[model samples]
Target: MTDLQFQCTGVRPEPFGAGPTLLFGLRIEEADHQPVHAIALRCQIRIEPARRQYEPEEVGMLGDLFGEPDRWSSTLKPLQFAHASITVPGFTGTTHVDLPVPCTYDTEVASASYFRALSRGEVPLLLLFSGTVFTGRDGFRAEPIPWHKETSFLMPVDVWRSMIEQYFPHTGWLRIRQDVLEALRRYRSARALPSWEQVFEELLATADAKGGD
Candidate 1:
C-alpha cells in the first residue's frame, strides 16, 4: 500500500462549460518518495455553514433555510455540496490535478439555497476522498484509499456567483412539476403567446391585477 495525502489548494469557475462548473485544484503527495502508477479518485464535498459569520442581510435572506439566527446552532450543520471524481495521472512524489464539480441553481437543492443566501465571503468546505490507489515498480498493486483521507477548503462565494452569472447572465432558473408544465403549455396555446416570457409577463400582470402579490 502507498501512503498518500490529499490537499485542496483552491477552486475557480470554469470559463466555459456546458453547465455551471468549478475546477478544484488538488494536490496528492506520496510519502516515502515512491512513484505512482495512477489513482482512481472520488471526492465528496460538504458545506460547513457554522464555520463562518454572516451579515445581517445575509442572515435574513437565509432565514427560510436555517430559520432565525438564534436557532442556527441546531440548523446550521454541514450540508453535502457536490460529488466529483478524477483519474490522477502517474506521478512521483507529488502531483496536482483538477477536479471538476458541476453545480445547480435549483432552489430545491440545499447546497444551492445555502450558496444563494450568501452575498459575500468564503464557503467553508470539507472534501472527503476515497478510491483505489495503484502503484508499483515491477508489478502493480491495488490498495483501498484510506477512509480518513480528507481536506478542508474555504471556497470564495464570488467564484460560484461568477460561474452562474456567466452561464445564466440576467436570467434565473425555475424547476416545475410536469403537471405545471402541461398547464403552462395549455395556457400559452390558448392565448397564442409567442414565447414563455410573454406567457409569464401576462400571468404576472394578471396576478398583479388580482393583488396576488
Candidate 2:
C-alpha cells in the first residue's frame, strides 16, 4: 500500500435561491516520499444546519412538502443537508482533484434525507469517478478523467470487490484482497450478530492478520 495523504484546498458554495450547493477540490500527495504509481481516493461530505422554530400553523409548509415530520410537537426545527461518499482513482503524483459538479436542492430537508440515507448504507448513494494513467516520455501522467452524474450504490461485499478489481485485479495483490475480503466477510457476519464492539474488534483483527500475512 502506498502512503497517501490528502488536503482539502477549497470549498465553494453555489447559491440556488434558498439553499446552496458546494463544490470541493482536494490536493493529494504521497506521504512516503516515493513516486506514486497509482492511487485511489475517497471522500465523504457532511453538513449540519442550524435549527429553527416555526409556529404550529406555519409548520404546515414543511408538512405538505416533506410529508410527516420525523419529529414534531411544540417547536419548529431547522433541517440539515449533507452529501454522500465521492470516490476517485488513478493518481501518478501530486495532483489537483476536482469533484463532479454538485446538484441543487430546494430545501435542506431534501438534502439531509439523501445524506442520512447514504450514511445508513443505502444503495445508489455513492458517486464513483476514475482517471486513467497516460504514458509519457519517462513515466505515466495521470490524466483524462471520467465522471458520473449518477451515483452507484453497492453492497458491502460488492464495494470491496469493486475496489480490488479497480486497483489490483491480479493474484499478486492477494494480500490486499485477503484483507478486504476477510473484513467484508466479518462485516457480513456481524450484521447478523449485531454487536458494535465485536465488529470493531474483528476489523482490527483482520488488519493485523493482513499485516502478519
* Candidate 2 regions with alpha-carbon error over 4 angstroms: 13-22, 48-93, 108-213
In angstroms, the error of model 2 at 163 is 32
lDDT, candidate 1, 1-213, per-residue tens: 789998999889988789999999999999976788999999999999999999988899888788988899999989989999999999999999999999999888889988998999999999999999899877889898998999999999999999899998987777899999999999999999998999999999998989964
Question: Which residue pairs of candidate 2 clash?
Answer: 52-78, 124-153
lDDT of 2 by residue, 1-83 (tens): 34444555554443332323345566766554545555443344322221233345534454643455555543223332233
The global Cα lDDT (0 to 1) of model 2 is 0.43
Q: Which ten residues in a row are the worst by lDDT in model 2? A: 116-125
Candidate 1 TM-score, true structure as reference: 0.91
TM-score of each: 0.91, 0.31
